[model samples]
Target chain A: MFYREAGEFKTSYVDDNQTFPIRFDRYRYYFVLFAAFLVIPFAVNDYWVNAVFMPFLIYSIAAIGLNILVGYCGQVSLGTGGFMAVGAYACYKLMTAMPEVNIFFHVLMAGGITAMVGMAFGLPSLRIKGFYLAVATLAAQFFLVWLFNKVPWFYNYSASGQISAPERTVFGIAVTGANTSAWASYMFCLVFVFICGILARNLTRGTQGRKWMAIRDMDIAAEIIGVDPLKSKLSAFAVSSFFIGVSGALFFSVYLGAVEVGEAFGITKSFLVLFMVIIGGLGSIFGSFAGAAFLVLLPVLLKNVLVGMLGWPTDLAAHLEFMIVGAMIIIFLIAEPHGLAQLWRVAKEKLRLWPFPH
Target chain B: MSNEEGYVTADGRKIGGTLMEMKNITLRFGGVKAITDISFDIKEGEIRAIIGPNGAGKSSMLNVISGFYVPQEGEVWFKGAKRPQMRPYQVAQQGIARTFQNIALFEGMSVLDNVMTGRLNYMKSNILHQAMWKGKAEKEEVENREAVEKIIDFLEIQSIRKTPVARLPYGLKKRVELARALAAEPMLLLLDEPMAGMNVEEKEDMSRFILDVNDEFGTTIALIEHDMGVVMDLSDRVVVMDYGKKIGDGTPDEVRSNQDVIDAYLGVSHD
Candidate 1:
């Protein structure tokens, strides 16, 4: 009853086709954005920024990227970690080489570089599909990790073979490397995420998004109906990798401040993002954020309860975290293959028809 | 009424010059031949039907026309120009649109979205414009939506516009597929087994819609069907194939009286 569009009418196609057509939804969205921008920066601390907000925000971008490819485009990829590494490494190279430029440009350029790499790996997808494509992307994951580790040039030939973000500022306030405040880093990543989210949301809701879904639902039919598989698939890879790369740039430069390729972006990292997509929902933007938040926050919540409160061993809590994530994945796959997005959809549907049993 | 170039049908609609012509088209999957030395021309604004028993390669011929299969030998001509070796989307860009033998609607997408995809060829806004979704992109989308809405209304699928194709019944799904193909506003519309697996009422509805679409849009149609009754009622001309060979090609009544077509349908003795 409270969530009704009874009196609200859309007078124009533009009004009807908005991202959030309902007044209530639109307001809620604005409120969330307001809170994230105005309120969170003030309230955020180093502990909350590093442990909770940073990971959630960063992974949300990655999940959005992976969701566009696997969820909307129907191309399964397990090379998210590798693409992120490409982003991280690209950002690192850009920062060190072009120290005079803005860090924002470096992040965007890093995303662009990763997008090209993603499209290169995505070529095999035109000839292969399903499990075969998955395997091909797995090869990309291995090759990329190997490239960063063996090539020492990627790390600027550092003696330690690790890439570190140098001190960089946006508007003269440090947003990367040491001496950066928690809010500075948080706001920096937040800006990227917000822009990425809008771009992704708009792309998915428009003509391009329809083409991807058309391909995902039925490739042959999509072709007959005038969707170019090459353009669609490659564009999906380009856009998805762009987001993933930006997140990777932020993950390395803003959040962690230092990174060893193997330790930072391994197979586990790939699986972690994959799990976020699976558990959150495959073909939903909201599910990306939901999955990222759920997975990112779960470990911290578990750690606090099990280790900090109950005095349980750290390793035990870590093991339990793994088991819980695994069990959640299985449950979501079995119970609701569409993930939490479907659940949210059903809830809204019910709310729409409230107070009357059909 | 008889015209200089082509004759008028019983309903007084003048059929125009050749829109698409297939000359000596031969298709094969490795050693297995699908269509052998088949030649046909679909006149503008006429309903051309291909009918044969199982394994007659009618579907393969449709595939060739739609550019899904590249004939090992032969030329496909559209609008008096020899079509190049191109992809399906290229063929679609050339105003050739088709529906599958099986319902090929995007099962996960709403009927509106599925139909909207038909306008992908007409969408000219670049990726950057689409990402921002303002100005040209928004205007183009609204324009496409208007076109799709008209088709939905034309097909009487307005009630199910927002419904996913997977949730629809067989008949409705078939209609949605037709709506999608029509949304392309194709010059040459190909329908493979449009009435397959439908009840008599559903078949009648499909036939009526097909005729209405042809009459209203003046769309040149080429279809494959197993039902002779629907074929005879709906198509102006019919092409009969048997074992990858064209057995007969004529008007419905001419094909009905052809000895070879009767022999092929009745399983006549080879000796």
Candidate 2:
């Protein structure tokens, strides 16, 4: 009875129409923000922050980008890692080419560069859809990854064709390379992610997002109802790629520090982001973050607990992580096809009705 | 209405003018003809019905008119403008909207959202205002929602406004689909079997709504249906087609007794 959503007074239309009208929900959201921005950073050790939380957040952002294209727009892609590679390489190129440019703008411009490349791959989507569309994207993923590996210019003319990060500053504050502190990196990531999150939320709620959903739901019906499928679909790709590209840039600059194409961003990395989206919630935006965190942290936590603390073999811990993650993926899919986002929603719902059977 | 086919308006509302003109519409799939030289006109604020036996290209004609299919030979004119072969969206933008034979709603989205999707083109809210949830975009949203709510009220779907379209019953889903088409506020509406799978009560309810839609919104309606009784009561004029050819075109009473129309349906098997 105490947990019910009833009697939540919404005096004005503005109050009534807020995304989360329930008082408890709004409070809970603030609690999460506090924990993420204030409490957790203070409490968590540098090891956890550097090795797990930071990577997870970056990957979550990338997963959010992929979910927009694949889950929301109904266009499956296998080129997330290729876009990431573009972002990483672009970031590297920007830093070296323009010594006087700020690191923050460089990272963002890197995101924009990836966006252009992602759009190029996304162009094939106009002629094809479904499985064929996925295959078409595969061409971009493979070709881009190969280009970064083979082209010396992408690697800044290095002999090994691998670009390494040079320590850089944003407004005289350290952001890139080993000299940069974890707090600066984390704060930078947090701020950018928040902005991107807000932008994405707004985009999905408005007319452009509706057009994409219409195309996703039923293209023929969408067309008959006055939604231009071609332009709308392309816009979905553009917006989706823009976000994913930015996430990729952030994942490289802030998190990885130094990057190589084949090792850091590749086909395997694409699967990593896809798994995050699948495990989080297919179309749910928050689910992308949740899925990314779950996937990113599971292995690290397993390694630490099973190997570091328990003195078990690294391979055994690795195998166990795989087994557990695989099993959870199956369980999550069977139990709730909507993913961890749905699970989180269910938990919140149950919490809302605690101590009441009805 | 037209001088050639006199349309008597209900309640003396002069909501009449030819909105869509189809001339010599021929659709062919390989050697088999789906529609052969069928010409028809739909007048503004009038319910025009196309009735025929199975495979007589009634739905095919609707599809052609709505730009789902490009007729091999014909001219489609809308609002006194010559219609080129446009995509379905182009037709929709030209003040034409349509519902499908099979209900195609976004199962995941709420009824309100589904209907709001129909007004996507009209609601020109960009990303910036949406991000801030203020200014022009938010204003446009409220305006569009008001229009959608009116349609929702008109269709008596206020209770199920926030329910997912998939959770709705067959009859309600059909109505929600209609609400969505209405949300577009089109001058012409094409309905492919509006009351296809309804019970007697639902059919009557739907018929009343259809009539109200014509009188209230003054939308030009072209529907393909099989139910003879409803067609006779609802349509100002009925066009009869067989094997894609217009066998008879006149007031319902004239076409109901036409020997050629009767022979097309009863004369032979799948003729």
**Highest DockQ, which number?**
1
RMSD of every prediction: 1.6, 2.2
Q: Per model, how many backbone clashes are there? A: 0, 0
The two-chain DockQ for each candidate, comma-separated, is 0.88, 0.68
Candidate 1 residue-wise lDDT, A1-358, digit = tens: 7468999998888998998887888899999999999999999899999999999999999999999999999999999999999999999999999999999999999999999999999999999999999999999999999999999899999999999999999999999979999999899989998999999998998899999998999999999888899999999999999999999999999998899999999988999999899889988999999999989998899889899999989988889988986787787789988888999888888887887848
Residue by residue across B13-43, what tens digits does model 2's lDDT show? Answer: 5645677889998999999999998888877
Please tell me how candidate 2 rates in CAPRI terms. Answer: medium
Off by over 4 Å in 1: B1-4, B269-271
Error of 1 at B101 (Å): 0.8
lDDT of 1 by residue, B46-68 (tens): 99999999999999999888888
- Which candidate gets the maximum lDDT versus the true structure? 1
